[model samples]
Target: TITEICDRYPARIVDVGPKVAIIEMVGTESVLEEFIEEVRPTGIVEMIRTGVVSMGRGTRIHDTNFINRRALADAAAKADSGNGRIV
Candidate 1:
């Protein structure tokens, strides 16, 4: 279902782990916000707005390490118990 939802937008799922995923979507801030809202209800325990790449120059303009380790751990636990879905 997550894959289906992402396919509706200009998004690429870059990577996926047991409890986390890296998704790259090309859009404006508003579009990003809308995407977040769209995916929030799909059992996504945590999401980190990792960075943005400039479309014109293909350069990263912003980056951050804003990950929530506790949430990720919790999500992992839930997935291990079949109570969560990795997004």
Candidate 2:
């Protein structure tokens, strides 16, 4: 049960779509097994399983667009550091 899994573990809710959410877990591997057990009988139309290859912690910037634009600008500024680029 996705709801039960959400209730049992610490997770982050990703906006996958209007009807679906990607529940990212931050707990032991055992919790994932439990989640599978709960969801199997729900008759939901779609479900996916994946393993986390790597993980990182900490906060993300609140203003994502602004941060992205700044990052792109910084990258552009450095692109011509050695052999100057035109326009």
Candidate 3:
């Protein structure tokens, strides 16, 4: 199972359980669609996507967006105090 996924696509296993496996493949949209088609026969229970994260070719730093560490910590603390809700 793992070998087939690895051979067909450069996917990283996120989690594995008795009935499902979550994987992530970082690549072009076409490649991602093709991989989905290839894996359709194996039963996909659910899929979640965070949208495209992109950068110019040959750039120095990754083009990821992130909250400041302190801001994140503050939000987390608020959520914890608010019973895990982000309000």
RMSD of each: 21.1, 8.7, 13.5
lDDT (Cα, 0-100) at 35 in candidate 3: 85
Task: Kindly report the root-mean-square deviation of model 1 from the true structure over all alpha carbons.
Answer: 21.1
In model 1, the worst 10-residue window by lDDT is 57-66
Q: Write the per-residue lDDT of candidate 2 for residues 32-51, one digit (tens) a residue.
A: 67765665575446566565
In terms of lDDT, the poorest run of 10 residues in model 3 is 58-67
**lDDT by residue (tens digit), candidate 3, 1-87:** 754865778788888888888787888778888888888888888887667877566543453433366678899999999999987
lDDT of 1 by residue, 14-83 (tens): 9888777778787778888888889887676756675675553323323322246666887898887885
By TM-score, the candidates rank as: 3, 1, 2
* Model 3 C-alpha lDDT versus the unseen true structure: 0.77
Per-prediction TM-score: 0.47, 0.38, 0.54
Using TM-score, give the best candidate's number: 3
